[model samples]
Target: MTRVSDPSAPRIAIVGATGAVGNTLIDLIEKRGFRYRDIHLVASARSAGTELNVDGESHPVRAVDEFDFSTVDLAFFSAGTEASRQWVPRATAAGAVVIDNTIAYRMDPDTPLVVPQVNAHELDRRPRSGVIANPNCSTIPLVRLLKGVEQRWGVRQAVVSTYQAASGLGHPGIDELKDASRAALDHPDETYPAKEFTPSLAFNVIPKIDRFLDSGFTLEEQKMLQESRKILGLPHLDVTTTCVRVPVVNGHSEAVWIETHGVVDRTELVEVLAGLPEVTVHDRESRHAFPTPATVDDPDRVHVGRVRVNPNNPRAFWLWLVADNLTIGAALNAIQIAEELVERRTL
Candidate 1:
């Protein structure tokens, strides 16, 4: 990851620089020119002292405990939840504002779960704490698109099902799917059960995502239901979700049914989505120009397609949206929030 443009910040730190999303965070921070004078990189203790390049120069990873946050202004925490939980407060307490990508603080009433294109104002509103939580990758694009709709015309209910990519589970999950697929291909009968997922996820889709609750909703499904309403600031909005893990290595796709307060045109709806910033509408049914993981593997734009009204219900419309699970979903969102903080003088 290369740092772009101005090298003017007093101090900045990127915790967990070696992981998939963490590495991507550095790539974007550098790509967008969120420059810093002292750019500190941290990882687990074992990964300390390993060198990473910024602006083509080597920078060694530091132990988190050894990192002095007294002079740091902005810190991007892309580590796992437990690491974020343990160190984020320490950094923030030292006066560095934290933009965390983990789910650690997302549901906290005081901590705003931010998506720049959606609830950027939530980050703009000050007088709260120092840390900000980035929304889940699966939730980011889906919620961002929905937020646009909700602001203009109210939406009453939604039924969403995700064709989530293996990347959502991180590196281990991706490897698990790959290994399972290889075994299935070789022996056909001696297939491995999913190492990260509950069922086999190689060339197969698992209907269950995350741990199931007694309430019968898997955690992933529940996150979609809950995070959508929270990010849109319509807590009472009815939303149902079914999250499935697919064999794709990157990008998560969704099939969504939106029930609005009033009837709306399918064509106009596509137009609205097309016009929205950071979103690309691919609504072509004749040639099947719908959003798929292969088509939008690494794009920043959220691809939307298959715009159609439900034949049985005119008020309800079905649509498809896809986004890169690693970048746009988590790292890019976090960096965008950091960019917002700089623009709004929050950091």
Candidate 2:
């Protein structure tokens, strides 16, 4: 891959441009002020012909089947695993770097699963196959916090239980929550209407995110463990995860417990986390100070709070973190990867 010396020379394409992540990417691109020679938005045939107004210009959404990837320098895909499975090769073979927000290529040895704050150095070497996988939404914030702790004190074990938002499933998930909430008000004794995978999400939490394996862990839970190991370069890192779907519409929350190799004092740990870019430390004695799904505002940073060291184990610590799943977890991260490539002249 040859580096593009001029930052404004690279033409960009956002595949799946009508979906949740794609829309968020468009919003953040405007907010972050990235200059590109040209921008293309491609989606499925059903979403084609839709006009998206960005940077004061209306760009018509084109069908991916008709759009050519050869002229594009970078592509961000979030359609789904199946679409990515079929199109990523074409994008790479045409010389465009693909930052995929799907599970399709994440575990592929040739593809680097990345969370920028945790392992931006992985971007130094462009993928030989011209593809990089964005870590899972829940995994993104979890790993972001762990990176600081792991660097200051080696990580031995990590336990995370996620309170994932409906948005993780896409716009349909959001719609389901809204419809269910309205239905629940009159039919409190009956199950609310559900067309999505969830049966009832308005007033309840489902202990499942993705399909369960024989080992009983959902795919979402396993992604956190496996992706964390790959990004942190910890092959045997002990990680236990439980992923659940909650009624919230945007942000994702996590209750985390970590055991490090050395004892890191509470004050020092707070300072270290605060020093990391895009991470906010808000631990306080009052419960009101702790982070919740509603507490997440900026789409770029991870909010952390409720820090405490285990009384019996000096090496163990617990905390809560929240982040905008659609923004920082998906779109912002994919954009950051593309930005990193441009900054390093690897585009």
Candidate 3:
């Protein structure tokens, strides 16, 4: 955390400052005491003129089109894929390093798709494309644990099913879930029109997230596979996923089944996971010890539980994980990238 008053601190801009992840970014900057010479908040035209507070000072939100990218040293783009696609190049061209939170630049050959816990070394130098891409929410937690497993016992393959929250869609998605749930409870016969999630997500789980690919997997599922490969530097990694949207408002959970090349010892497995940077493993010592999205105490750390190796197949094991989609998945990762850049003098 650099001193805000220091003349050398970066001048930063937060695009999509009105959205869920954007708001979380502001909160984290305050909580972590992230310093900057100046901070600008930018959003769409509709959200312009609105005021948001950072470090107890009020700042007016500026429309992205009107804000000059050259004014900032670093810009974080979380608006959307289209927004990032439209504005990221402008920001980078203006000599501002961009940390993008969209899918636009993630798979680009020159852009680094980063998860700080797994690969902060990637930020040792300025990116060739002048932008760093954050991995998907579910992919972030999965890859963090996978890094440890792949090092301890070579990972043969991984199968994951994500129980993603409505917050994955941002603020509107949460509103729709609450409205749809209320409609269902008050009037059981009527259907609540679902805009964020198709066929309603109230008291229901939809197995499809994002759109369907020709290969029968949704785009969200595809992102997990592709992003995991890029972040871990495993091009041909066998990671298959089924992404589902649950009714919860925040926090994404995953049930992972990983088969390694060697036999796994449960005691050592727990120790390996527990030793990771910010992972908490709840073993099966108590009858009710696993972490749920609602009960997980820390939003910043990844929570893991249910450590059991298949007795029949000693090479495979099962684990459950929960992480805040907005924080660990999006804003927090973006800020951490900025922190790494500042520390390494890369930005």
Candidate 4:
């Protein structure tokens, strides 16, 4: 196994540095104080030569084909599955430990799909393939909150409906929404753009996220169920999800119902979730007390609220959860894993 001897200062590379997640990862690495001896910004051919400022220094972005990955100690990949599929093997062969954000390897039995706060222990086995998988943006917050509950009361089943933001598709999705919104405002009857997201998304919501499977669940929805079970080590855990694309451009929100094996107590649920360092519970009787998708902007915590036991089933409870899909859900989670590797000296 290739291990990074010096945790304080390791050479780093950022794949798809021109993307939203890649940009956010650069900021988070600096904010979290992960020291790096050197940093390389890599993108596609079109994005090459673009200058990106990191920690007061301007780094020129180079095409992945032109960049050398062998010297870098750690590489964070967010260039989509196609790019990841093409470069990940080359990177691993060149001795760089890859933390992939794309779906290319998340379901691979050999690749450990992880959210550090929830399943850092899985990293003990290390990566024989030199690749670590980051869960989907929708799966991160759900699992983060479920981890504590699964530990305390043993969750038997969970159902989630996610209000995903336009940011899930990066800048293109955000731009499409904005353009459609403007067109609708200017001409109420005219048809606007429908590119990234199917069926208009400006002043509406789409119930589908990724391609639909024969099971009637979209790929994005199935990810929530499948990835949750994997990270929590509950193969039989009954999980269902419906992923929706909302107009919001920052955070993702979910209305979750969970059934535990034992009885559900509201007070105990709040205490257990609040005790987690990475979760924040904001619940009350007031109208604006619960968390909203726009409220969690670039946050590190998974905001959970509306904690209550279902009247029909004493063993079941409902929760409203919100989180920044770009940060805690993506970039920050990857950074946490890298930091964990450093602290454990496993990278």
Backbone Cα, N, C clashes tallied per candidate: 0, 0, 0, 1
Q: Candidate 3, residues 1-347: lDDT per residue as tens digits?
A: 43377877999999999999999999999899888999999999999999999888889999999999999999999999999999999999999999999999999999999998989999999999999999888999999999999999989899999999999999999999999999999999999888888889999999999888899999999999999998989898999999999999999999999999999999899989999998988763552589998999999999999888999999999999999999999999999999999999998
Against the unseen true structure, what C-alpha lDDT does each candidate score? 0.81, 0.87, 0.93, 0.87
lDDT of 4: 0.87
Winner on TM-score between 1 and 2 is 2
Better of 3 and 4 by lDDT: 3
**Location of the lowest summed lDDT over 10 successive residues in candidate 3:** 280-289
Q: Evaluate model 2: give its lDDT.
A: 0.87
Best by lDDT: 3
lDDT of 2 by residue, 202-236 (tens): 88899998898999998988989999899988899
| lDDT measured at residue 340 in model 4 versus the true structure, 0 to 100 | 84
Candidate 1 local lDDT, 193-302, one digit each (tens) = 65687778887888988789999999888887778778888889888888888899989998988988777777777778877888888764342687788977447789
Assess candidate 4 and give its TM-score to the true structure.
0.95
- TM-scores of the candidates are 0.93, 0.95, 0.98, 0.95
Residue pairs in collision within model 1: none
Judged by lDDT against the true structure, how good is candidate 3? 0.93
| Model 3 TM-score on a 0 to 1 scale | 0.98
RMSD of each: 2.2, 2.8, 1.2, 2.9
User: Model 4, 1-347: lDDT tens per residue?
Assistant: 12124546678899999999999998887787777778899999999999998887889999999888988988999999999999999999998889999889988888999998888997885698799999999899888888888888888888899999999999898888899889989999998858998888989999999999998999998888889988888888888988899999889999999999888778788888888877878873342467887665439888888888888898999999999989988999999988888777776
